[model samples]
Target chain A: MPKPLLALGCEGSANKLGLGVVSHDPTTNKTTILSNVRHTFNSPPGTGFLPKDTAKHHRTFFTRIAHEALSTAGISPSDLSCICYTRGPGMGAPLSSVAIAARTLSLLWDKPLVGVNHCVGHIEMGRVITGADNPVVLYVSGGNTQVIAYAEQRYRIFGETLDIAVGNCIDRFARTLGIPNDPFPGYNVEQLAKKGGSVLLDLPYAVKGMDCSFSGILAAADLLAAQMREQDRILSAEGGKLKEGEVRITPEDLCFTLQETVYAMLVEITERAMAHVGSKQVLVVGGVGCNERLQEMMGSMAKDRGGSVYSTDERFCIDNGIMIALAGLLAYETGFRTPLEDSTCTQRFRTDEVHIKWRDD
Target chain B: MTASTGSQDFPCVLTLDVPFPTARLASIALQSLQVDKELSALVRRTFSISSSIEGARGDSDKILKVEYKATTNRMLRVAFNSFMESLNLVVEVMEELDADVLSTPIAA
Candidate 1:
């Protein structure tokens, strides 16, 4: 039997170091993911963030996950054709950890090392899973949220949040509610939104053109909670027993309203971008891409445009290693291998900065 | 430090004096150095060229200031140095300015 081309992708931009393994299916001209693993970090001590410490997390997670993925795929180092890792647009600590480990593995295992852009990997992984060609991308995550389109050898940013990402805004809102971020609080908020019936709380909606202003929305949400708390105090002082849903914006209601507003903002901007690019298909990627609300909104927007919206499952939606590996494989094919001496790690690297000379064959 | 010669027209006062070629080289040199390794690590990524220029300071070659800021630390300083050295440009230690705060702007 012919040996399979084993490709591994590594991702550790923020809290998770994801590992993904794939076997290139020659007949289909597509790569199939075999196994994926994500290892989260232990929030660093002192400053609440440490580059070196996070890098350490990437290293540890990458090593363990890489081994497990290989084993799970029933392959060994010799079967591996290339090793790919997240290159940038991330925290330096985490990026370097993966880069250093990847380079080491490539050298030791004698495999070509491919450096993949973190953002592009997110986009491509979405494209791969959805099988969407030349689709407009709505990439929303903790670190970034932008409507993008590939053009003229680059992924141009069509529209974006002026300050902070959608996920970041949600996280901040969760914090105001004293919601724990552990075990994925965003998911919890989504679940809560499902349970609580709508209370119809009014809040500011600030969407300017194709861009978004999350600051105003964040402030509005925060103030709404504060006002609700004061109302509860007044109600209690007036010798009145406040019902569970009275004088309080149920977490579900808040989640429902917030998701509606955010997803609407995203859908409008993405539709504008699609029209700008004259594209019909839309591919939603990133952590927030996993949101059912966002997907549904995008689906409707696409329908209005006489197009379609495609999103990856949870595995590809969140940052994982397989996307990196796939991206790396393409980049390597196009001669994007960084020289060992030239290999370095960084926390920030914009998507536009990279010239897209590589593609999936 | 307060501006030595405050002029409303200028709003900010600065000085630049170098040989013609050296001034030009200085600006180019600075542009290349701004993305140096040490700074890239601090900022956390590689940076693209923002801007570069050359000016006159007598007959000798002088590169003027080049300004750039990397989004993340990617050892751009090292890459830049290697790029300049490959072109036979030897960078000298010049005054490194801070980026509107305690953080010193990394210039390779």
Candidate 2:
């Protein structure tokens, strides 16, 4: 029996810094996550995380989390096959910080390095955790929103956001309402949206072919929020509440409307991709994949097509090192290793750029 | 015949060795500062973090070294001023919002 392959993955594509260790058994073709650790850089409300700050967060937490992951996995550097780090499609500074850390670990441990694409990491992890084979994937997050499918050894992007990502839309809206950044702004928005009544406020739904745009909707929503705030201020100044019959929009309403409109657009594009690919299985991956509303909507769509929807909870869905480990392990099994000199990270690594040597289908 | 040295021949150079509590902070500062492109062709800048010897020894000690070169003292001072503004913002944000500073572990 061949010894199980172990890989250490470091991820800091955005505000989250994740470190995880995973092992794979070639005989059974099974992958096991030994340890997964993450640290998020949450900024104050109304302020997005700048690349510099996010990169700093990754650098500060990289070593501590890496140590914790290795210790928790009970594996020494000698036991690892490779060190995998997110190479791209993220903030340049954060990606570089993590990449440099990975390079340092490679030099320290005398191990080879594997640079993993952030999107592919999410998809591979989702497939491994949920056992979804060749499913149409909806990869949504703060930085990216895309509907992807596999074909000819490539994760073909069928639909994607033309402007701001879906998660970014939700986050900005949360800031407009001055929501707490603890946990996450999106989670807070999700909570508030639950309290909202079924009154769908009018917002732009921009879907062009298989692509969608969120900036226009974001602007429209911001305007609505501003108007709502002004109305509330005026009403409070008059020492009176909203009139009995006057139409009033609350923050909860704005959140609910935003989720509905944006998620509907996402669901539409995902469904289109599924239809185009003629695949019934839908896998939702990324930070926004943890949203129950999205899963529920995707589930309904897949169910209508006589199929099932697969999604992991926050642990696997939100950016984590385990995903990188899993994907890199697969690539490693296929004799893929990034040489030290070529281990440079990029900010715009596309999913298709990776040669899917591990998968035949 | 006489040899002459011009001001351009002796470029103004500035080096900053900023220390952080941890090598991670220093690396962050280095990476953040490295993003700013050279504003002037006459001015050149380079940044690097000191290797984490203390990290290898299980201690948090790091330093970021930045070097600037400009053809004239005025150009050097002007570029240095802009770099300082960005560097200050990065450090301030790191001090305020870094997970290590907040003592919050991000593992679930």
Candidate No. with top TM-score: 2
Candidate 1 at residue A170, lDDT? 83
TM-score of each: 0.72, 0.82
- Give one digit per residue, the lDDT tens place, for model 2 in A27-119: 798888999999999999888899878877886776678778977997777788998988888997788777766765665456889989999
Q: Kindly list the per-residue Cα lDDT of model 1 for residues B6-68, writing each as its tens digit.
A: 234322232222222334334443443333255333222222222223333344444342222
Candidate 2 error regions (>4 Å): A239-245, B1-10, B14-108
Going through the candidates in order, their DockQ values are 0.02, 0.07
Per-residue lDDT value at A315 in model 2: 95
Against the unseen true structure, what C-alpha lDDT does each candidate score? Answer: 0.67, 0.83
Q: By lDDT, who's the top model here?
A: 2
